[model samples]
Target: MLDIMAIISDGIGGGLKSVLNIAIIVFPLMIIMEIAKDLNILDKISDFCKPLTKWMGVSKESAFPLTIGLVFGLAYGAGIIIQSAKEGNLDKRSLILVSIFLVCCHAVIEDTLIFVAVGANGFFLLTIRLLTALVLTILISKKLPSLDKEK
Candidate 1:
């Protein structure tokens, strides 16, 4: 009984520790993102992404969250994506394109750095991921119906 109690306690402690670690990362990221948004830095990033997004056949609305997800990771980008969708900023086709792109290649910088720490070639990995995401997003975006057609 004592052993069982200790095991249960350890499990609970581990779970709480994991949650705390996640909150530590996520909260700071969110705060920084909020500040960037307010400072219009996010708009600049979105503007920089416009040509890439145009090549992918998505709108400028999708570019902002897509750029954020590409740089910061899904947890950071998801909030903006949800807000944009709720506000009807992105059309269905653009949302679909952005979702697929993010799924394939979100967290570019962090994930590449992590893999590099484990002896992977960060440049090669980043290139492959970016290329795969771009090609797939472009192809899928072409296959999907246009927003105007939906309405």
Candidate 2:
């Protein structure tokens, strides 16, 4: 029937619109991230995260990816994390800790802003996410066996 065909068409069109909307946001964010990396802005942000990395007992190499994940989200940060791992900058323990922390609180700024737009309390949401990530990372770090022995 014509109604069935119309429904199918509408579904496909709606799906494409959703994908396009996400691409619009993601593409610009990725470009900006590349620009920041080239300009060494990412290094400065990583430096700022050193204390947090130390508190979590992960290596200094994890700071950059951790910062990226917090600011940009895991989808973007995963590239940096993978590169660092391939370069031997991150050990197993560091990778696990970074993954744990990021999983808990990736994309704080973007997520908070989106929620705030929908009438959610941004500060409270940000605080809870950050705290949860910190506490969970630290606790998990303590539980993971030392990588030194794996060698």
**Highest lDDT model number:** 2
lDDT of 2: 0.86
> How do the residues 26-59 of candidate 2 rate in per-residue lDDT, one tens digit apiece?
6676688778869989789888999999999999
TM-score of 2: 0.74
C-alpha-based local distance difference test score of model 1: 0.82
Model 1: per-residue lDDT, tens digit, 51-125?
A: 988899887778889888987789767887888989999877888789888999998866776566556898899
Tell me which residue pairs clash in candidate 1.
none
Query: Which lDDT values do the candidates have, in the order given?
Result: 0.82, 0.86
56, model 2: CA deviation in Å? 0.3
- Per-candidate TM equals 0.71, 0.74
Candidate 2: where is the Cα deviation over 4 Å?
1-39
